[model samples]
Target: MMAMENLKQFLVLLSGAAVFGIVSIVFVLTWVLHFREGLAWDGGAAEFNWHPVLIVSGFIFLQGTAIIIYRLPWTWKCSKLVMKLIHAGLNLLAFVFAIVAMVAVFDFHNGANIPNMYSLHSWLGLTVVVLYGLQLVLGIGMYLIPVTPASWRAAFMPVHVYSGLLLFTSVIAVALMGITEKLIFALQNPKYKDSPPEAAFVNVLGLFLAVFGALILWIATRTSWKRPSDQILHTLHTNGGSEDNTKVSPAMSQLSGGMDAEEAGEVRRRNNKFDDNTN
Candidate 1:
């Protein structure tokens, strides 16, 4: 049991490190690549690179996927199932709108000026943000309240896998779109003379993939281990089980009791007396 527990703990930590490592890498890249002095919406000249935005969008989806995956059931529960499904669906919806927005923003602004595409993209993203907020509310309510999480419920296995599927699909879709939009803009921009679209794209895409890969590794490596509370659970379960068995044993034994000859004779005499009284 100790070995099993240690192995489980090792796997869990490895998985968690992979996820955190990816997030840290991506966050650092976002800071490095997109943190140019002129990134404001105002007339200020700023550095504009769409790759970081794309990667960030995917990172959020990845985060949501991780949440949904962890919450997904190892056992059956109607309540858990519904919440997981809704969480998955909402995140996916948010992902779709967010991707559209990422592309639109890239098209609308290439760091020179805020374009119409940027406004549209911003609006679209805002709408999805609303959706994500709703999801957050629903997800929380499921934990606290006693409703079917919302009107839909399902089994835990599908809830876990489907939520992840939705998250991955939505994020990757937006990320790819954002990347394309940025690349196209770079190709068309006149101010950026030294950097090749190919090189910039490769750098952005490479970092994004690397970060995302680490997170995936973590998710795949997940293993179960008993926490410090396991001892408490073991004791409670044992005592409760023993108490129940003690109570039930005598009742069961009496129900299975057989009468000896003398007892049977006594019972017959009592029955005759009762019959005589009735007559």
Candidate 2:
């Protein structure tokens, strides 16, 4: 059991490192390497560059981080309500950045008299953005609004969880497609007939994005990594006194019970199998 716990800790650390590394690579690739002069609204091609930077920073990295916020140890020390607000707030910022990036793309396109939605990347990207917007609205309505019935929230929980993961994956995919399209479009100086240094670097960037996405999913989905019900209640009680030490909602209680049952059953089965083998 000690060894297993150690292994899980190692995996979590490795996953966090991957997330940090990938986002760092994205920053270097966008700001340090490919950045050009006058990258502002009136700067023509430079203005379009914000699209990649913001999408990567906001949609890919921040959104991915938000998805795994529950897995963070520090977050387990805080009230679940506080963590929920942080998670929602991070996602909201990501959505805002994405919207601004979209505006940058359209502004550049119009200014340059270029046609829009001409590439597969653009279509996929636009679709992801629209779905993401819908997701934010539904999520806020279901989870954040005081008027939202607990029963309705409970019913929607599974769908909410599923769609959130789906959108995170889709955002990564769309980002990859966008990166590839941009590389092909921008590096046509030599017509991109062969592998160049810039092409290789950008390809690596895409790979990092893919790796980061996979790592986040791995961290978020691990049953062993979930915050226990006792921890949630303890944290709330410690932070906000007895009056605020509310029991978890039915959905959370059910989830906790389910996880506990699974762990208990697994242990019992292992012990029974061992006794049989010994006999």
Candidate 3:
């Protein structure tokens, strides 16, 4: 059983690595080979080029990594608090990249006298970015802020998780749409439009994005993949040099062993909060 579990974990890790590799290849093929015009603020199409490159690297790829960070073997040795910080930080970076990418598009538009938000891709991209920013803020407030009430945290947890997955999916969808729109709009040549190498490469890139998202969601949604309570405790001890102050929540307690009356009450409260959220 132990060996089987280890093998499962290894396969999971391999899947994640493969996703990352595909993402990197797609990035290079899109930004480096197809469009060699590096980023520029005032260079019209060159400035606009940053949008896809940054969006894919930061929004899609890095964001996927942030979502699956918990499954990474390196995180097992780190304190949960540290992992939380890393998670938040990575997301913030992704958000920054997305914001800059959007900015690049706007800047290019103004410089080139082109209209903005004129396509389905533009509208969906804007909406995803806005919701993603809100998700990040609420996540930080709920999880990292020590003063947040346990009731609030419990109530918000489900929404947070749901919205995160939703937004991640939305980002990938928007990216695929954006690339398609770009291909249709920019590829004016008959040869390029009719099954050209660039078009084929980008279409494959879109498939990569979809596959990466699938692998990430698979790892994230697996119940057995959650951090073991014992591992969490061990990490806390290693980081703090003592375990006297760390308080495992009811959820963790339930995972570890039998729940005492107090823990049972806590679980009831959590359930009530969840019920309220459902309503």
Model 3: residue 145 alpha-carbon error in angstroms: 0.9
Residue pair clashes in candidate 3: none
Q: Residue 211, candidate 1: how far off, in angstroms?
A: 5.8
| Ten-residue stretch with the least lDDT total in model 2 | 249-258
The candidates, ranked best first by TM-score, are 3, 2, 1
Clashing pairs in 2: none
Instruction: Kindly give the number of clashing pairs for every candidate.
Output: 1, 0, 0
Best by lDDT: 3
* Cα lDDT of model 1 by residue, 1-279, tens digit: 124454465456545645654654455355435533323333332323333443354445344444434322231123333444554455555455455434544554554456553543344444545555554454444433445422232222234334444544444444445444444444544323446645464456545544554555444333332121222223324445343222211111000012223334544554464446448
Q: Against the true structure, what is every candidate's RMSD?
A: 16.3, 7.7, 8.0
lDDT of 2: 0.68
Residue-level error in angstroms, candidate 3, position 229? 3.4
**lDDT, ranked from best to worst:** 3, 2, 1
Which whole-number lDDT from 0 to 100 does residue 232 have in model 1?
Answer: 27
